[model samples]
Target chain A: MQAYANPTRFNALALTILPWCVGSTVLLFLVGLYYSLVVAPQDYQQGETVRIMFIHVPAAWMAMATYTVMALASAVAIIWRHPLADVAAKTAAPIGACFTFLALVTGSLWGKPMWGTWWVWDARLTSVFVLFLLYLGYIAIWQAIEEPAKAARLAAIVALVGFVNIPIIKYSVDWWNSLHQPASVFRMDGPAIHSSILIPLLIMALAYTMLFLTLHLIAMRTEIMRRRIHNMEQAEVQG
Target chain B: MSFTAPHIGFVLASYGLSALVLVGLTLAIVWQARSTMTRLKDLEGRAAKRRKPAKQVKPQ
Candidate 1:
């Protein structure tokens, strides 16, 4: 991990792996979408409306997972001062923000049909909303601060503080009597959903994971280039 | 998959909105990266040219 912390080495590694990531993301999305939309059987209760779970569940999963990654990266940046860690955290924010937005929007879309409400202040929903705000706040920190070091420091602190919300988002359904459904896939009772629907959900989850990997690599590369440009400009000005 | 599911419009809207937002965000990031790289390259090239003439003047 430390070896890759060097930006030059990281860029080399990213360049090699990026093609594979792109290829896998494309292949997985194609197969996953086909399986999700065509092969997966409709839910006995929700019927065709269950199709939304294919996209929604995976997106929500990515939203949570990306936040966790950002928090970890931020921690590394703060604790170890890993050269590339700040870049990783900064590059991840927009991608995670998009996923969080997708999760909320899709959740709302699902809610309106099932819960008969376009929006709700329920614990699960509210926690996820807070997660979205955290992403926004983190991004805004970077934009608001003029100095790069100061921006990264402040943003890292915000990311770490916001890490508290992740568990709440995860357990909100369990803790409260909410409209949101309890965990089925990761629960001890072992997947309340049937295999037919479960297969598509899993595929979609894989697709979302691959998509995150693909985007993260690209974002990191662009960030590295941006930093290089910044350095060159500084040198030019000084010389 | 029933063609007759209730709230089909909502489902479609959700997917459409997600796609639009994702595509737009991706494009915006890519554009910014490209533009920044181009500006950096231009600035560095000009700097190199200025240094080259200064070196010649010093030798004379």
Candidate 2:
């Protein structure tokens, strides 16, 4: 990790690994979609409506996972002053926000048929809403601050503070009377779901993860280039 | 998977929306990266040109 503290080396590594991420993401999505649409059985109660779960669950997971990545990067930026850490945190905001938006919309799509409502002010839904807001707020901070150094510090603090919401989002179903369903995949007693449904769901989740990774590397490289341009402009102005 | 299945519209809508959003986001990021890479290369080329020593003129 320390070896990647230099953006140039990090960029070289990202270039090498990016093609693999893109290929795997495409393959996973193809296989995952096939299983999700054709192989998985319809739910006993929800029937065809359960198909929404394939996309909704993975988007919801990635929403939280991306923020976790941002918060961890922010923490590293603060603790180790790792140069690329700030870039990682900054670039991840938009992607995480998109995931959060998908989660909310898809969750609503799932909720309508299952719960007979488009939305509810429940713990799980509300907490994830807060997360979406956090992403927007973090992005806004970077745009609003003219100084990169100051923005990095302020944004890092905000990310670290907002990370408290992740656990709340995860366990909200258990903590309150959420209209949302409780955990089926990750549990102390092992997964409650059968393999038929679980397998495709896992594949979709992996596909989403790979997609995030591929996008992140591209965003990070773009950011490094932008920073270099900024520094070069500053040098020209001073010299 | 059957189009005739009950509530298939909702399933289709969810998948459609997710695809639209994710693809749009991915495209936007990739586009930005391409433009930024072009700009960086341009700036680097200009900087290199500035660093090059001017050719010496022979006394005429």
Candidate 3:
């Protein structure tokens, strides 16, 4: 972690790992999709609607996972003043926001058939929605602040504070009588679903994680370049 | 999976919507990275040029 704190070394590492992430993401998605859509048997209860779980569950997981990454990076930025931490946090917001949006939309699609409603103001549903808004607010802070240092500090604080919502979203179903279903794959009982469905679910989740990593590397590289450009432009004006 | 099965529309909707959003997100990020890298290289080249003549002038 400290080693990659230097931007040059971080850039090089990101470049080296990015290609492998891309390749694995493609392969994993292909294999995961085949098993999820082609091989996995439909749920006896929900039947065809169960197919939505492959995409929805992964998106939901990534949504929370991305923010967790952002919060960790933000903490490093705040505490250790790691040069790349703010960059990582800023770059991740959009990707996380997109994942959150995907989760909500896909969840709704799943809920319509399973719950007989498109949406509800329940604990699980509302908390995930809050996560989406938090992403937006974090992104807006960066865009609105002209000073990079100040923006980074403010955004990092927001990210750290907003992380409280993650647990709320996760345990909302368990804590309340909600329209959303309880945790099936990641519970104390160790995945109540049979291995047939679990395998593809895990594969899709892995693929999503790889995809986020690949995208984060690219986004962070772009951010570093952007910062460099800003410095050069400032130098030119003063020169 | 059976396309003709009941509630298949919901299943298709979920997959289709997820696909569209993910693809769009990927494209947007890639485009921004490529364009930003290109601009950064251009600016760096300009900055190098700006420094080169100044060094020679200082010695003269």
Model 2 CAPRI rating: high
lDDT of 2 by residue, A35-133 (tens): 999999887777877778888889889998999999999999999888999999999999999999999998888877776778776666777889999
> Looking at candidate 3, what is the lDDT of residue A140?
96
- Candidate 1 lDDT at A78 equals 97
In candidate 3, stretches whose alpha carbon ends up further than 4 angstroms from where it belongs are A165-191, B52-60
Candidate 2, which segments miss by more than 4 Å at Cα?
A: A165-191, B53-60
lDDT minimum window of 10 residues, candidate 3 chain A: A182-191
Q: Write the per-residue lDDT of candidate 3 for residues A148-222, one digit (tens) a residue.
A: 999999999999989976676657654664455544322111236789888999999999999999988998999
Candidate 3 TM-score for chain A: 0.90
Identify the superior model by DockQ, candidate 1 or candidate 2.
2
Better of 1 and 3 by lDDT: 3
How do the residues A192-218 of candidate 1 rate in per-residue lDDT, one tens digit apiece? 877877777888788789878878888
Q: Which one wins by TM-score: 2 or 3?
A: 2
Among these predicted structures, which one has the highest TM-score? 2
The docking quality of candidate 1, as DockQ, is 0.53
Candidate 1's C-alpha runs over 4 A off are: A168-191, B47-60
DockQ category of candidate 1: medium
